[model samples]
Target chain A: MTEQFVAELRRRATIYWEKHPFQQAMLAGELAPDAIRAFVSNRWYYQASLPRKDAAIIANCPVPAVRRRWLERIAYHDGAAEGEGGMADWLALCDAVGLDRADVLDPEKVLPGVRFAVDRYSAFAREASWVAGVASSLTELFAPDLMGRRIEAFRTHYPWIDPAGLAYFEKRCVQAPREAGHALEVVLEYARTAEQRAACADALTLKCEVLWAMLDALDHAYRGHR
Target chain B: MTEQFVAELRRRATIYWEKHPFQQAMLAGELAPDAIRAFVSNRWYYQASLPRKDAAIIANCPVPAVRRRWLERIAYHDGAAEGEGGMADWLALCDAVGLDRADVLDPEKVLPGVRFAVDRYSAFAREASWVAGVASSLTELFAPDLMGRRIEAFRTHYPWIDPAGLAYFEKRCVQAPREAGHALEVVLEYARTAEQRAACADALTLKCEVLWAMLDALDHAYRGHR
Candidate 1:
């Protein structure tokens, strides 16, 4: 049943945002310069939002072991101190793409649609079961493949962007699968009932839709530019 | 100083969503049939979201008096029973607009942008001080005028929509000022410091921006249709 459940979760890859036309255009190097800036800048909202949701998960979880593991996820993106972690890496990417760092961090720079979609992640973590929160993080399972392709695409097509800015994507290529494995272990152990497993599957679908919806807004906004 | 502070909050009317072009087009009765549907459909997300945010404020609030008062706002929207209240009236609006009731309630039908903007209110309510949450609800101060005008607009321009569907607006025209007055008393009593007053002002701005941003997404999506 667990194997079948995991497989059911994997089937959702058919709708994974990696298949999104905006992402496809991105990997194919067809995105305009402005579109690239828009992605990096707007995406900063999601990058910046990660640690808050992780903190929510930690706040809601009762188990020390679980909280300890979740703390690492927060630190992974937030780093040991300010100016250090994945968020900084994303800001660097923004800088590499010629977007002002202030603007990237500015709430005004984020599309209401993108902010809406990303805020759902935080709300889900705060409102759902801790196990379900972990399940939502299963988007990591699909991230590595997209990261690998993105790195290659950037290197070959968007060579004008500095290599250093790609560190966030590069690190995720290694970090995501490990995190996904950890999250899957937690979900499998806790989400034992058929109903719980189904809820986790629904959470995964919500995560995927959150991502796809973010791009839907971007695609709508940048259609003319693209 | 309190009068000045209240005056400052009132000044935000300039940026209130009543001024959004889409809203302007809406009140002017210039919106196409498709635009009206998009407006009603997407506005449902915001209407539906109101009680949840109010609940967040109530949950975070320790003051029973405040909670008692705020609880009324939730009941006002959600009604005493499921089939009553503003939500049911909104479903009627949806009916008037030709959208299916189930589709109006479906999370999938909501624009991510609209959802994002609306979700921010909940997050703010959960994360900020209870007093700040009341300040955020100060958008009620601006709602009655818009509601009155909206009723007139629908009666004058879009007579195709059933008059019954306008009940939500008609009721809010009476309800909003009373609610806003109560919220202002809370803000005036609690936000005594200049810094606290400024934060309340900022919260009001955030609420205004939330309303504006919801329309931004709708405007972008239905621009050509309009």
Candidate 2:
């Protein structure tokens, strides 16, 4: 049953945003600089919200042992110290992509659709159970593959964007599997009942929907009928 | 002892940014429209972070009764639904102040100092004891007096801004004392030891520093000499 439950989640990867039209266009180099800029600018919101989301998960988890394991996730994104971690790498990517750091930091360019989607993800983490919140983050299970492809595509196709900006993807390629493995263990351990397993699956599906919706918004704004 | 602790916090109001030179200038009509715009843009980040901060406080709190009371703070900021609450009132003020709603919502204009200060407040809430977190919020205890003075200042000195933009201040005037009252009760009840009382005092002082630093940044950027 546990194997089947995990497999059910993996099956839904068929609809992951990596296969979304917008992402395909991005990989194909059909996206304009403006489109790429829009993606970078808007995606920063998600990166910025990560520590807060992780903190929410830590707060919700009642067991000290679980929280001890979960604390590393916050340190991973926020860094153990200043000028480090995933957020710094992401901002570096923004800089490499020619985004003015101030503009990206100030985030004046975020679209309504992008903001709504990201804010919903944070709200979900805040409102849901610790297990469900961890389950939603299981989207990381699919992330390593996407990051691998993204690095290759950006290197081969988007030559104008500095390779340095792709550091976030490279880091995630190494980090995602480890994080996902931990999350999977947590889900497998806690989600013992049929109902809990189903909820976990549903949470993964909801997370995928958020990613797909983000891409949908990007496509609507930047695709230009291509 | 509790009364003495509360009085000590009130004594620190001597350093409140209301008495800061920049705020004094603002109240005196010495600031340019650009300065006021900068203040509004930067302050929006603080406003945007409030619901999330409140959520952290609620999540850290283990007691059901405290969570129930704390839940209202989130609702007050985020609204019972959409297009309501303090956030909406703030955005309306943004609009009244002639800010492009997109610019404010995109939040690209937020200053580094403002963002740092606000993020620190959120982190403090997430990491500290529930009682300490609640104590930091005691800034609201001094808020009503500021809000009352601010409404008068804006009306008398900044007539160019729409009266409607001042709604957040008006709403907060009625809201601050009540919220502060609840927070005080929590602090008095939970912060029983001398060490706990000192920690609570320290939290309020840190909060005050965040607010003061925000104004300092604003003054540095916009004061443009006497």
Using DockQ, give the best candidate's number.
2
> Which candidate leads the pack in lDDT?
1
Predicted candidate 1 versus true structure: per-residue lDDT over B1-226, tens digit per residue: 8778878998865588888999999999888888999899999888877665775665455444565566667667766564688878888889987888888878898999999998888788778887888899887686668888999999999988889888888888888899999999988988899888888899999999998999999899999875
Residue B125 accuracy (lDDT) in model 1: 79
DockQ of each candidate's interface versus the true one? 0.01, 0.06
What is candidate 2's lDDT per residue for B1-226, written digit by digit as tens? 7679889877755566777888899888888888888888889888877766766876566443555566567667766555778888988988888898888877557888888898899889878888989988887787567888888989998899999889899999888899999998998988899999888888898888899999988899887943
* Interface alpha-carbon RMSD, every candidate: 16.2, 14.6
Error of 2 at B102 (Å): 1.9
Worst 10 residues of 1 chain A by lDDT: A59-68
Task: Encode model 2's per-residue lDDT on A31-106: one tens digit a residue.
Answer: 8888888788888888887766776876566443455466566667666456678888888988888888888877
Candidate 2: segments with Cα more than 4 A from true spot? A1-7, A10-226
Fnat for each predicted structure, in order: 0.00, 0.12
lDDT (Cα, 0-100) at B186 in candidate 2: 91
- Give every collision pair in model 2: A106-B107, A106-B108, A108-B108
lDDT of candidate model 1 versus the reference: 0.82
